[model samples]
Structure formats: C-alpha cells, structure tokens
Target chain A: MMDVADLVERARRGHPRAVARLISLVEDASPELREVMAALAPHTGRARVIGLTGSPGVGKSTTTAMLVRALRGQGRRVGVLAVDPSSPFTGGALLGDRVRMQDHATDDGVFIRSMASRGHLGGLAWATPQALRVLDAAGCEVILVETVGVGQAEVDIAGLADTTLVLVAPGMGDSIQAAKAGILEIADVFVVNKADREGAQSTVRDLRNMVALATRDWKPAIVPTVAARNEGADDLVQALDKHQAWLEESGELQRRRLARVRDEIEAIALTSLRVDLRDDGRLDTLADRVLAGSLDPYTAADELLA
Target chain B: MMDVADLVERARRGHPRAVARLISLVEDASPELREVMAALAPHTGRARVIGLTGSPGVGKSTTTAMLVRALRGQGRRVGVLAVDPSSPFTGGALLGDRVRMQDHATDDGVFIRSMASRGHLGGLAWATPQALRVLDAAGCEVILVETVGVGQAEVDIAGLADTTLVLVAPGMGDSIQAAKAGILEIADVFVVNKADREGAQSTVRDLRNMVALATRDWKPAIVPTVAARNEGADDLVQALDKHQAWLEESGELQRRRLARVRDEIEAIALTSLRVDLRDDGRLDTLADRVLAGSLDPYTAADELLA
Candidate 1:
C-alpha cells in the first residue's frame, strides 16, 4: 500500500499522479481514507469551489472547458472534476470530453479528472465531497465540478460548491426544465450558453423572468455566452467572481462552509456506520426479521439502533 | 386518530379517501405506518407496477393518460401516480398534469394522485414504494408511477417498477441522454412518443442501436407512439403486456418483487436507523470524537456500532 502521508505531500506539491491516486482512494472508499482525510484536513478550505451544472447536450463540457481556459489566462491553477455518466455511452462521451478540453492537457497549471459511477447506492454522491477536499489540499486555487443538473447525482453538488452556475441553451427547454427540476433554486448564476444560436435571447429572458420571481436576496444573474467559440466567457467568469464576493460579503460563504463541513462529517460517519452494520451482522438480523414479518422494520431498526 | 385496521379495510375495499389517507400517512412518515403496512401487506403483489419515466417535455402525463385508457378498454382498473416536481414551478405544472388527465379523474375505477417532494434527503425516493402498496391493496390491477426521468428522485423507481417504460421524443436528444444518464439500463421498454415529429425515426433507430449493444437477456422493445393523438398506444400496451408475460414466464417478476421487498425493508431500516442515530445521541458522540481528532470517522462509527 502506498503511504497516504507521502501521497498527500506529493499532491500538495501539485504532482498529477499523486493527485490521481488520492482521488482513486476517495472513489474506491479505500481503507486509508481516514488517514488521508486527516492528512488533507488542514490543507483544505482554500480553493474557490465552483459547480457548473446543466442537462446533457446543453454544452456543459464545452462551458466547463472555456471556464478553465479563462481562469488559466488569469494565471490561476485550476482543477476539474467531471461527473462522467457511468454508462455504455461514457466510453465515447468522456473521450470526447477529454479531447474537447485538450487545450489544458499540457498546461501545468490545469488538472482535469473524470469520475465514473461506482454503481453502489449513494456511492456516486459521496465521492465528490472528499475529492474536492483533495483538490483543495493540493493547492488548487479554483476547483470546478461539472455535472449534469438533471439527475439524482446532482443533489449533493450544491452542498460542495461555493458557487453554482446553471447552464442552459436556446430551444433546449433547459431554462424551464431547470426551474421545474428545482435546479433554479440552487443557481447562483445562470449562463445561457450557445448564445449565437437562435432563441438565446428568449432563453435569457425566461431565466431573468424566473429569477425575478425568486424571493432570495441574491438574485441570480443571467449571462449569455457562446461557449463553443469561447465568446463572452470572461463575463461568465466575472459573474461567478462577483457572486463569490457577494457570498463572502453577506457571510453566506462562511455559513455555507460550516454547513458543508457538517454535511461532510455526517456523510462520512453514515457511510462508516453502513460498513460496520454489514460486517457486524446486525443488518442481516434486522433485515431478516423484517422480511419474515416477525418484526416491523421500524421496530427492528429501533432495536438494532438501541 | 384514524384507526389503522379500519383504514386498511376501507383501502382494500377501494375507498378513494382511505387510499388517499394511507398515501398521506406514508408521505408524512406518520407513527402508524407500521400498522398500515402490516395490514396492507397481504393485499399487495397483485398490481402490475409500471414506471413511466422521461424528461419534462416528453409528454409523460399524456402517455400515461393514453395508457390508462387502453387498459380500461380491457376493463382493468388503473392507478396513476404523478411525481410532482414540488418546486414553485410545480404549482402550475401539477395543475396542468391533473387537467390533462382529467378524463380519468372522473372514472371510479381509476385513481390519479400527484405526489410532491417531501423536501428531505431521500424523501422523494422513499414515498413511492409505500404508495404503490396502498394502490395495490386498493385493488388497482395496474399502477403507473409517472416521474421525470432526471433528478435524484428517479433512482429507486426502477426498483419499484415491474416494467419501466422510458419515454423519448423527437429532438429531445433523449436516446443519447438516456444512455448517458444510465436510464436505458433500467428500461424494459422504450417508447418513442410523438412519432410523427421530426427526428422520431432517428431517435427510434438510436434506441435500437443502443439496445442491441446491451447484453441483457430481455431485449427492450422500441415502440413508437404519438401520445397526444392517441396513436400507436395499443402497440405500446401490447409491448408492455409482452414484457410482463416474459417476466412471469421467466420468473423474473417473482425475483424482482422479492428484491423490491428486500430494498424496501433495507431503506426503511436505514431511514429509521438514521433517525435514531441523531435522536438517541449516538451520532453526537461519534461526531464529537471524530471532530476532536481523537478518532477517525470509521473507528468512531465502529465504536458506536459496538
């Protein structure tokens, strides 16, 4: 087994292999996770975490690539975590993702990683939190989590992000779909990507109208951009930065960070509890009793818990 | 307080109010849920549970309406559960859903209910299993759970469904998106709705191509339908019946139902455990120990379990 402490040191020094190994440890729920988290704990909390989310075919991968480039232009070290759909389709799509983002492949300042689903219940949702921490500990100034906004996997990304940019495209019904999916509630900023396409103005208008109806103090700004051609990307970055400033000035960032810590701790503890529940034989006993109808699940749970 | 035994009897006798109240008890996590489930247990396993899943604008409600009509033509009682998005957008859209299905609303043999999100972690995923039981015990020969294909909430619907029909439309990019979201894996049948629309044939071709790539024993059949025009709905129903017959002959239905029960038992047990962990002080003790750096979360969890 590789020494987690050594890996942490190497990762802190911006070694990609070490960084990749750390993420692998997180993804696999390795036995060394505790030691790694302990090592990483002190070095985290520095990265400006951004979550860029959208439905498939809405240019999410493209927008994420452009955003990384814009940030790299400002001399900031960037890390990207792409939430790959763990399906037969990902083999080709994730390859396309890598090829599309190849501009940053040789840039020493940028690191990009794609995560596939682990196929365990709640497993996909749990890995990103720890992976973000690893990136933060590795001295990344900006860490971006790119995910499709419409799935069950999108729920926990909001908890991990300091700012969330929702991407939509004209004729995608994405703006309205985002609203219906409750992704709108979590949007700190909305980007109407593919602005050069017809109906971009209408999409932006729809987003603004919905934003107006939101009762939150921080109204989400609608920024139009053609992400494919890298047009208006700086404005998108500026919007994200301004939102970050607003979060900090309003003390929401601190509150969000505190809640994130609580979430991280709870998630980790619950995952551990689940592990022990299986190994200790209590889950089987409780499940069997419930299945046999000898005990109600709630009552059996109470017994096991007690 | 309502009498659980009496309500169960009323529900089994097909009283709409009783069925509604039982579903409400499940959604609210009422104290008498155990009694309700015990009483309703024997009456379940009779209803054919079908899950209709798709993106927002793919005409899920319309297809559901047509499916119910086709089933009713054969004199089979039907139940419809619309998974309401439960955002601000839901208020209008849910109304639209009801209005669109109002044809069945007046049918004494049909039960159309809309379920809103419970706004808690895992809440949206938890309600369906119990509601399916209620509808089953209420003597609905077929129960359809209609949900938007995207979102964290849609994960467990496949487990609850005996047949999962994934709906796609022309220009939705839904075939590729379905493959990307791993929705295609859960589909026993694929419905290319709005068949007269442009690109419908290509969508059908894409689904067939992907279906051919899958190694499952049961090949998911692609059925084309124009749900609004009520075209090809009979063929969709025939496809569903064929799949159901295959499941029964192959004993897959029995296995799936057993797995569904096991999943229900496990999920309920876990939810109850989480409840007690927080309320009975175990979580606090473990959390504090981990937070104080005296122990890692894994070890603390082991100590708590022991």
Candidate 2:
C-alpha cells in the first residue's frame, strides 16, 4: 500500500507521480482512499473551477488549450481534466493527440489528465469529484474541466464548476440544437468557436436571440473565438473573470461548493452501502425472496436497510 | 391510509385507478410502499418490457400510439410509460395530447402514464423501476416505455427492458450521429421513421451499415415506419417478436431478468441509505468535518457508513 502521508506531502509539493498515483487510487476505489482524502482536505477549495462543454466537433479541446495559456499568462497554475464519457476506444483516439497538448507538457505549472468513465451508470465515473479534489489540493490556482455536451455527465461537471462555458461552432448544426437540449440552463458563458468560418455571424446572432429569450438571473455572455489561431483568448478570459466575480460577489460560490460536497458525500455513502449489501448476502437473500413471491423488492430493501 | 391488500387486489384485477394510486405511492416513495410491494410481488415477471427511444421530434409518442394499436390487435393488454427526464413541463405538454392518442386513451385494454424525474442525479428518478414492477403486477402483458434517447436516463431504461428499439427519423440528422454517441450498443432493433420523407433511403442504408459493423451475437433488424400514417406497425411488431424469440432461445432472457432484479434491489437499497444520511444528522456532521478540513470527504463518508 502507498503511504498516504508521503503521497500527500509529495503531491502538495507538486510531485506529478504522487498526484497521478493519488488519482489512480480514487479511480480504482482503493480502501486507502479515506486516509488520502483526509490528508489532502486542508489544501483544497482554493482553485477557480471553470468547466468547458460543447457538442462533438466544437473544438473544446483546442479552446481548453488556449484558456490554459490565458490562465498561465496571468501567472496562475492550471490543471486540465479532459473527461470523455463516450466509449473507451473513441476516448483513446481523441486523446491520442495529447502530444499536441504539449505546449504545457514541460511546465510543471500545467497538469493535463484524461479521464473516461469505466461504464458507470451516470455516464460519469464515480471518482471524478474525488479526482477534482486531488487537483484542488495540489496547489492549482485554476482548474479547467473539459467534457463533451452529449450526456448528463457534462451537466454533472457543470455542477462541480464555479463557471461553465458552453462552446459552439458555426456550421456543425450543433449550437441551436444544443439550446433545445437544455444546455442553456447550465452555461455561465457561451463561446462561438471557429469565428473565421462562414456561418459564424449567423450562429452568434441566433445564440444572442436564444440568450435574450431565457429568463435567467445571471445571463451568459456570448463570445466568439478562433482557438486554432489563438484569436479572442483575451475576451474569453475576461468573460470567465466576469462570471467568477459574479459567483463570488453573489455568494453563489459558497452555495455551489457546499452542494458539491454534499453530493460527493452522498455518492460515497451510497456506493459503500451498495458494496455491503451486495457482499453481505443480503442482496441474494432478498432476490430469492422476491423471486419466490414471499416478499417484494421494496419490502426486502426496507428490511435490509432496517 | 390505503389498505395494501385492497389496492393490490384491485390492481391485479386491472383496475386503472388502483394501479394509478399504486404508481403514485411509488413516486411519492410513501412509507407504506413496502407493504404494497410485498402484496404485488407474486404477480410480476409476466410482462414483456420493451423500450422505445429516440431524439426529440422523432415522433416517438406517435410511434407509441401505433404500437399500442398493434399490440391491441394481438388481443393483449398493454401499458405505456412515457418517461421524460428533460423537464416536467415538457412531459406535461407531451402527454397533454392524449386526445391525439385516443386510440389507447379510452381503451380498457391499454393504460398510459407519464413519468418525469424531479431533478434526480441519475437521469432517471429512483421510482421508475418500481413503477414498472407495479404495472407488470397489474396484468400488463406488454409494457412499452418511451423515452428520449439523448441522455443516460434513456440508457437506464434500456437496462430495464427485455427488448430495446432505437427510433430515427428522416431529416432530423439523427441516426448516424446517435451511433457515434454510443446509442447503438443498447439497441435490439432500429426503426427508420418517416420513410416518406426525402433522404429516408440513405438514412436506412447508413443505419444498416452501422448495425452490420457492430459485433453482436444477435443482429438488430432495421424496419421503416411512418407512425403518423400508421404504416409498418406490423413489421415493427414482427421484428420485436423475432428479437424476443432470440432472447428466449439463447437463455439471455433469464440472465437479463435476473440481472434486472439484482439491479433493482441494489438501487432501492442504496437510495434508502442516501435517505438515511440526508434525513439524519450524519450528513451534516460529515459535511462539517469535510468543510473544516478535519477529515476528507471520502473518509468522512466511510465513517458515516460505518
């Protein structure tokens, strides 16, 4: 077993191997995870969490790279969690260009990681929030969570962020359709990427109209960008800053962080309880009772819980 | 204060109001739920569960209506659960067209209900599978569950079903894109709706190619339908029959049913555990520990579970 104190000390001192090993423990759900969490808890809750989500082919990865530069230019240590809830093979192919992400590869101030769900029920693997905690405790000043906006997993990522950016491209028939899918509710900022493309103006106009129609207390700012050319990065960073300021000034940050904690705690508790039930023979006995018509599932579950 | 025995007896006799009341108890997660389940346990496991899913504007509701007619033509009693995990208001709007579904609305042989998640973490509410069990025990020989295929909640529906039909429509730009999103893995059959529309043939061709490319023991049949015109409903039913026969002959039906039961039991047990944490002082104490940095969330959760 890895020593929790040593790992935490090394990870706090910015040891990449220690941090990576800590994350692996979280993913494998090792029994030593509790000790690890206790050790790292003190240094967390200081990072500015920014979530970037968009439909496939919207250039989210490229934009994430650009934002990493913007944050780095501001002298902030940055961490990127590239989360793919799609199939494992597809995620592998997508992350194969990790070398292209090498702009920060040699810089210890930037940490980039790829995470794919291991066939979890909610599209997000159960360990993502814990992994985020690891980054938070590792002295990262800004953490960017990047996920594709195809499933509720991305929405869960939004719940873990202080500010969420919804990226859209000009001609992929992705943005307007995204609005129809409730993507507007979670977005704190709207990014129209590929601004050099032909239909960028029309895309921005349609998005502005959609924003006008939503009855939100905090309206999402729409910005245009060409990440491949490093265009409009400043404006995008400013929008993020505006949202961050709003989050802090309105005390929404405290509320959101508290909710994230509550969710994390509940998830862990539930997972542990499931393991107990499945392994303690309670589940098999109940299943037998249910199958034999002596008891129903609800009653059997109640009995087990009691 | 309803009597469990009375309700179960009435529901078993196929009294619609009794079945509705039982479902309401399931949704509210009432205290008497266990008693109700115990009474109904003997009567379930007899219904054929079929799940139909697709993106918005795919005419799933209309397709459901046609399927209800075809099942009635087979002299079978049917139940329909329309699950909308998007928004309750949208669910209300979609089901308000009950007049448009007049073929099943007034038929004693058909029962239709709408269920929407009330902001549950999993795209599906915790109550759905229990509600399905209630319907099964209430003499529903065939149950059709219709849900939008865009999110993980629909994927949950696929897990609860014996047969899964993925619907696609012409001009929606849906099928191939959905396959890329991992929708093809859970499908037992694919229906290309709106065959009268332009590009229908190409849509069918693309879907057939995708299905052929998939490495599955049982090949998913592709059928064309125009639900608005009530065309090809028989072909769809035949395809369902073929898949059902395959499942039974391959012994996959028993395995799937057993797995479904185990999953249902686990979900109920875990939900109860979460309720205990949230309603008791345990969650607050753990959150306080996590917030104060005295204990990390993972360890705090382990303590609470212990």
Candidate 3:
C-alpha cells in the first residue's frame, strides 16, 4: 500500500511518477485515495483546465497534442488528459490516446495520460477532472482535457473547464447535425479541423450563421486548423489566449469559474450520497417495491428519502 | 392557478385533460407543479415504463406508434411520451412525433404527447420521465417513452424504464457505431426496425453477435420489424411480454425496478440541489474563479463545499 501523504507531497513537488500514480489511485476509487485527495485539495487551483470536445474523427486528440506542444513551447508546463471510449468486453485497456502524441512523450515538460470512460455514459471519463487535479497539484501550468465527441458527457465538460473548445470537422454531413444546438450553446470557441478539406469554407459559414442566431452577447470565433499537419496550431493557441483574456476583461471568467466550482462540489456530494444509498441497502428495499408493482418509482423514491 | 389537489385527483380518475395539464405544468418547472407531483407520486409506478431508443431515421417513432397500436388493440390503455430535438432559436418547437401516431390520438384509450429536448444534451427530454409519471398516475397501463437517437442522453433512458428496447436500422454504417456498447448493455430487447432495408438481415446477424459478446447473464433477444408496414408489431409486443415474464420468473424484475426507482430519486434530488445552488448565487462565484486562471476548478469546488 502506497502512503497517500507521501505521494501527495511528491506530487506537489512536481514528480511525474507521483502524479501518474496519484491519478491511477483516484481512477481505481481506492478507499485510501480519498485521504490523498483531501490532503492535495488545498494545493490545487493553479493550472488552467481547458476542455476540448467534438464528434469522433474531429481531430480532438491531435488538437490536444498540438495545444500541449504550444503551451510547452511558451515555457509553460502542460498536462493532457485524453478520454477515449472503453471496450466493454475487457475492463483493462491501453491508454491508446498517447499514440497521437507519442513524439512528445519523451519531452520532460509535457505529460500526457489517456483515460478510459470505464462504462460511464458521459463524454468525460469519471476520473478525468480528478486526474487533472493531480496534475495541477504537480505544478502543470495548463491542463487540457480531450473528451469523446458530442454526447451527454460532452455537455458536462463545459461545466468543468475554465474555457471550452467545441471542435468541428468539415464535410461531416450537415454541419448543423454535426454541431447540434446543445453543443453550440456550450462552445466558448469553435475550431474547424481539417480546414484544408473541400467544404471548410461552407462549414465555417454555417457555424457563424448558426452561432449568430443563438446569442447576442460574446460571439465565439471559428478558428480553422489542420491539427494533424500542425497547420494553424499557433493561431488556435492565440485564439484560446484571446478568449481567456476577454473572459477576464469582461469579468465573466470569474463568474463562470465560480459556477463551475459550485457544480463540481455538488456533483461530488451527490455522487457520494448515491454510493452511500446503494451500499447501505436503502436502494435494495426501494427496488423491491418498484418490482412488486405495488409502488411506483416516484412514490418509492419519496418513501426512501423519508 | 388551478388546484393541484383537484388536478391530481382528476388525473387519478383517468381525466386526459388533467393528465395533459399536469405534464405541461411539470415540464414548465412551475413551483405549483411540485405540489401536484408530491400528491401524485404515490399514485405513480402502476404503469410499466418502457423506453425505445436508436439512431436517427431508424424508425424509432414509427415503431413506437405501432407498439402503442398493438398494446391498445389488446384493450390496454397506453400513454406515449415522444421526445423531439428542440430548435436553437426558439425553445418552443413542433411536435412532429404525434403526427406519426395521429391514428390513436383521438382514441380515449390512447394518449400521445411530444416533448422537445429544451436544449438538454441527453436524448430523452429533461421533462420526459416526469411526463411519463403523470401518465402513469392517470391510469395508463403502459407508458412508452421514445428517444430521438443514440446519444449521451440515450443512456439515461434505460435507467428510467422497466424494460428498454434499442432500435436499429439496416445499412446504418457500423452496427457497433449505430448501437454503441454503452447503450447496448442497458437494452433488455433489441429491435431491428426498418427490416425491409437491404442490409436488414446482416444487421440482425451483427446484433446477435454483439449480444453474444455481452457478459450479462440474461441475454437480450433481437427482433426484426417493418414498423411502417406493421409487419412484426405483434412479435415486438410478444418480445416485451416475454422480457417481463423473464424478469418475474428470474426474480430480477423487482431488483431492476428498485434500482430504477433509486436512480430516479437521486436524479430528482441532484437536480433540485443544482437548482438551489444556481439560485443561491454560488454557481456564479465558482464560474468567476474558473475564468480567472488563478483558481483550478477542483480546489475551488472543495472551497465551495467547505
């Protein structure tokens, strides 16, 4: 058994191994991990957590790799948590996301980790934000979280990040279908990956027109990029920087961060309560009534809470 | 301004207008609606809630319409809650779902209501399960909830239903992509809708293979149907009946129902807490921190809870 206190201390001092080990502990949901988190919680809040999400094949992984490289080039240490779909058959799988940024793995300034969704339905792996915290505590200046495309989980990502980037690809059928209204609302910045593709201009036009329809406040800028080729990577980074600056200048940045904190705290509390309810056998009794057809679910829930 | 107690009582006695009105109130999230829900909670759970979900254009709506027709043909009263995608411009949108089932809307034994997602990311509308409860309280023997497609929100539908049916269509690309493993694991019965399509047979074969890969003890059965022609509507209903029987015989029905009830209660509670947090202005503070690069979200979250 690893001493969580020792690990926390090492992680706080910028040990990559300690950071990696701490993230694994959190992902495993080991009982001892909670103690480590409690100790490390105070040391967090240093890194800028940015979330990137889009549909599959939207170059999210490549984009994330590029961002990490850009941040590192600017003398800032970077951490990347790339979430991928987990295979149901085998609970254990490789963090294959590293393949996209394999060239940067040997670079001391950049630390990248792949996370599996672990049967979680949302776009984010349940352990992602927590893992990002471990990196933040380890002194990473910027933490980038890449999520699986536009889905239920993706919506939650916006609530977790300081600035959220909604990535889109050209020629993925109707741009509107690819960029659903739900996703459009959350994007602080939109990136048109594969900008060299045929329908790039039209996709950009559609996004601008659609975004124009939704909000009268700050209009999100659409940045064109070919992440695989590293084309326009620097501009994308500048766009992110500009957005961050605007958020601070407008004071909306502080407002969004405050809201994000409240949501995370409430989410953690609710999750804990759910686990307690299940483990304490209250859920079993409620399930029994629901199955018997004698009590409907809504009523059973009320009784359980009572 | 109407009396909630009167509405609950009227709905209990099978008043369609009262049921419709109550659902509308709940969907609108009116404070007075909470009182009606509290009163009707005890009356819910009498009806079996069934969820039908699949990829877009997979004949989900058509299948739901046919299922309602078949169930009603057996002299059982039915309620249908069809969730549609909402437009970004106006929160209010057309209810195209009920149009497909127009034949049954006039029948006293059948009631159909279409719900828009209200910009919520999840497949089933946020107001969907609550609407189903209203129908359940109104003496509907079976309540069928149809989702727009397989997305982040689709996974949530399974947690709400006693039995879940995953619909798929032929030539819809990869079966695995169309019916992602996340949604597949929750399905009790799989229906290959639009079986008249050229690749229907192969789709069924692929589904059978996928079901075989699932590690669950009780294997879900795959049924084929031409929903438009109503060719296999009877078989689809029979499959649902068999699933119900399997649940009863295996003693798993009660267990699953209890789990669903517990989930519903927790979901409601968490939603309530989020609403409270938002109203108390805590969320705004957290959002502010997130926008400023100084505070990491996880630490900020801990502070908010403390």
Per DockQ, the best of the predicted structures is: 2
lDDT of 1 at B71: 94
Candidate 1 chain B worst ten-residue window by lDDT: B84-93
Across residues A145-260, which tens digit of lDDT does each residue of candidate 1 receive? 88754334334567778998878889976447535537566888888888988998888888877887888889998889888899988899899989999999999987777666
- Ranking of models by TM-score: 1, 2, 3
lDDT of each: 0.76, 0.77, 0.70
lDDT of 3 by residue, A189-256 (tens): 88999999999999898888878887636678789999888888788888888888888899877666
Cα lDDT tens digits for candidate 2, A1-306: 557899899999888888888887776677888788878888888888888877657888889999999889999999888776654113433555365688788889988887765554333546778888889898898999887553353247667788888888889544365344466678889899999999999888887888888888788999999998999999999999898888889988888888787778877777666667767667777776776677788777777777
Looking at model 3, residue B290 earns an lDDT score of 48
True interface contacts reproduced, per candidate: 0.15, 0.44, 0.17
Return the lDDT, model 2, position B185.
75
Q: What is the TM-score of chain A alone in each candidate?
A: 0.92, 0.92, 0.89
The best candidate by TM-score is 1
**Tens-digit lDDT track of model 3 for B1-306:** 578898889888988898888877766766675577667766776788888887556877788888988998899999888665442211212244556678886798887887654533222433666677789879899999876544443346776777889887888646345334665677899888889889889988888888888888778888999988988988889999998888889877666666665665555554554455556656566645543545544454455545
What's the CA error at residue A211 for candidate 3, in Å? 3.7
lDDT of 2 by residue, B127-147 (tens): 778888889999999999887
* Higher-ranked by TM-score: 1 or 2: 1
Residue A121's C-alpha lDDT in candidate 1?
42
